[model samples]
Target: MWRNVRRPWTAGRLYEETLEAAMASRPVDAEARLSSPPRASILLDAEVQPMGPLAPAEDIRTDPATWDPRLERAYYDGDLRAGEAVLELYSRGVDVSRIQRAFSVGAFGLSRLRRMVPTRWSITAVDDIISARLRERIKTYDWIPEHRVYSLEAMGNRWVVLMSPGVWTYESIEAWYPGTTWNPTEDVAFVGDWEGPLGRVGYAGMGGCYYAARLAVTEALERERRQARVLVLREIHRDQLMPLGVWLVRESVRAALRGRPARFDTLEEALEEAGRHLDLPLRFWLRVSETLGGGRQETLSRYL
Candidate 1:
């Protein structure tokens, strides 16, 4: 109709039109673009909190060379659940340490997925499972009547455990010195804490030592048939250049708990006594501690 509607198609106009057309078109894979990545499957199906500690395994052979064929068969059976197998061995009265060693050596787990777990992880996992069980039992018991403090030094680590008469609660505070295992660059003391009923939000900053100490304290409380609010203060000195596995903390606290604890009539007295054994000022510990600091604030509110 007219002389061929002649309009210049400038490069800029062509590009702009093309871009607008493309933008107006529907997405080719809208579903795929909007969807999130699938979540990973969990390996273990057991409850997060342990129901109870495994029964001691009787006459259990820990050495791989000497293990019973039936036990090995049971662990490798496709039908047998890995967590159930672990609990079975524990129920059989197998020492938890032995069970942990078995797991470390790849002696237990699903037949297809069996593999060696790192010793540190194995230790903490076992400790956590057992501690959760103990916590349940300890919570039912009565709280200790008085504040008590226990102190010990070993493997370049000094431990001071202050226990107050109350329902079951625990907190571990660690002071790391310059040149120590995890604080190599620090020029001053560094403090880290794991607190609350839910425990630390993630892996403890002080490593497996936190779980080890928790297990030790739980064991002591279980033995005494009492519950209490526990505060564990650990000081890692500069001399501790080498990383000793958390067993040192576990054993040292165990030993301290085994010995007589210094008695105090009040929480203030207990903290004051524990202060004598620590390098940091008592105020520093109190200020940084969630349990202790919060308790102090609450107490002061009453007087005000």
Candidate 2:
């Protein structure tokens, strides 16, 4: 598979088994130094970058030719809203196999690659697989130091963000269409790094909507000290999104979705309900923005 991983990070079709293989080859914690990352020769730099980072740009939004109609409608209708999206999956009651299936879209969704893939406890079974491999690796070798493994229980698969930071990281992602630059400054997006062991922690960084959409749920889960945020994004990219795109964009949506049997029928209703969960109502922008923005109001306002 290593030979087959021509584009390991982006286009490579990574299965749960692939995760096991990578972990089997990884170095133990003692051997892992403060390195940038492994030499993933299979990385396809272009495909990992999402085309929708420019979704907020007036030029693109007004120009229908550049953006997909369904995508734009879903974005406006709150289908891609953060909290709403995550809760949808959490409420679905699916198993780890589905979670693994969801992540098959080329290297665990760029927004959650580090969070879901390299970490000890993953949102999907792959994390378990990796951990088991790590444990086995330890058992097979005495030199491997005993280290505290890290795993995450995302309440929803759709919302845990892996935001990228810095300009080069964005600009270099020319694999995306022209004029599309990764926006680290927008509230529509947020920050996170790749997932790894104890020493490899994901940091907040600038990002695209793949992770941006998750920022809302990520914050809420962290706020509530809940499990890993769950999600049901049709796909990570905006160009190819799922139908019935109702993003449960806030706390109310999460609660409503978590209610059994999956009650959501539409996106508008989801957004309306999500408003109820907020400290401020949906119609009130200033108040809701302030609450959601926390202290980062100034920086976030520019994007909103």
Candidate 3:
């Protein structure tokens, strides 16, 4: 796959692999140096530069005839901020993925403030911004009538979304099995983050996957005009040996939520249903979950 990369490097070739490979090949002095990590290049040399404004290609002119009218206006306007542009685009029925791509290439935001953003950061930024606005609107909606559990398994991962009757609150938990992409040790690793009615203040410990899954869950609630305390539990199996982008979390959770969820009369029954699809026991999940415990007004159970 290295030879099949589209970009042609004048100096030499490039190799693309999972992050696990890069970490394994790290030099002994990588931790001691203040500079960047040693790149895993074979017969190739490259230069690194500080963050700076990006220059667009000369021939890439905007065609008014084929562009969305609002996005076109945002492109030339010098006053609209990036966050406002994103919300407007979404209201116009634009796809989030399309917005992310345009934002990456400096197509949105004030003309003077535009700069190319790394694809990874731009994805999370757009997701977080749009979802934050959605959360505000969802707060006014009624809570779901009952506990619901939605489950899906794909790409060597199992996803379970447990939505309980309550106000707008959310949490995302991930259990990476040994030999998986992020967990290389003999023991399974559990990490999670949560937000209450007031919303979270900083970046989640689980990183972009938290925002990505939250975006999907909130979109579902917005559609039905309902709110709930959402808990997303993911089990990353050993088969998931590579680190794919956060899109996996967003799209897979969206697909799971779209399916018919098993309804339950009580929170206990919902957790029992969700436990069947995952490899781990429910007690282990509760040990690390704050949203399920009592992050909101009501506690699901007194699990210790």
Please give, for residues 1-304, the per-residue lDDT of candidate 3 as tens digits: 2222222111131211111122121212211112344444432111111223333222121212345555666666768899998898888887777777667656666665566566667788999999999999999999999999999999899999999899888999999999876677999899999998889888887778888898999899999999999999999998764667787889999999999999999887888899899999888898888866655224445544
| 1-304 per-residue lDDT for model 1 (tens digits) | 1111122122333322322222221212211121244344432211121123233222221111334443555545766665666667655666656666655544555665665455677777777766767778898899999999999887777889999998777888888888775575766565555655545567766567677888899989988999899999988887765665666777788898998999989876787789898887777777778777674686533322
* Candidate that beats the other on TM-score, 2 or 3, i.e. the better one: 3
- Lowest summed lDDT across 10 adjacent residues in model 3 is found at 13-22
lDDT of 2 by residue, 1-304 (tens): 2223334444233333333332222222221122244443432222132222121111111111232232223223422432232233333533322333333422232233222332211232332333223322332322211111111212221221111111111000101111223322322222223222121233223222223223333333334333321322211123322211112222223343344322234333333443343332333332332222345455444435
CA lDDT, candidate 2, residue 50: 20
Candidate 3 deviant stretches above 4 angstroms: 1-70, 295-304
Q: Is candidate 1 or candidate 3 better by TM-score?
A: 3
User: Order of candidates by lDDT, top first?
Assistant: 3, 1, 2
lDDT of candidate 1 at residue 220, scale 0 to 100: 92
lDDT (C-alpha, whole model) for all candidates: 0.66, 0.27, 0.75
Each model's backbone clash number: 8, 24, 0
Best by TM-score: 3
Pairs with steric clashes in candidate 1: 55-90, 56-92, 56-93, 56-94, 57-92, 57-93, 57-94, 58-92
**Least accurate 10 contiguous residues by lDDT in model 2:** 165-174
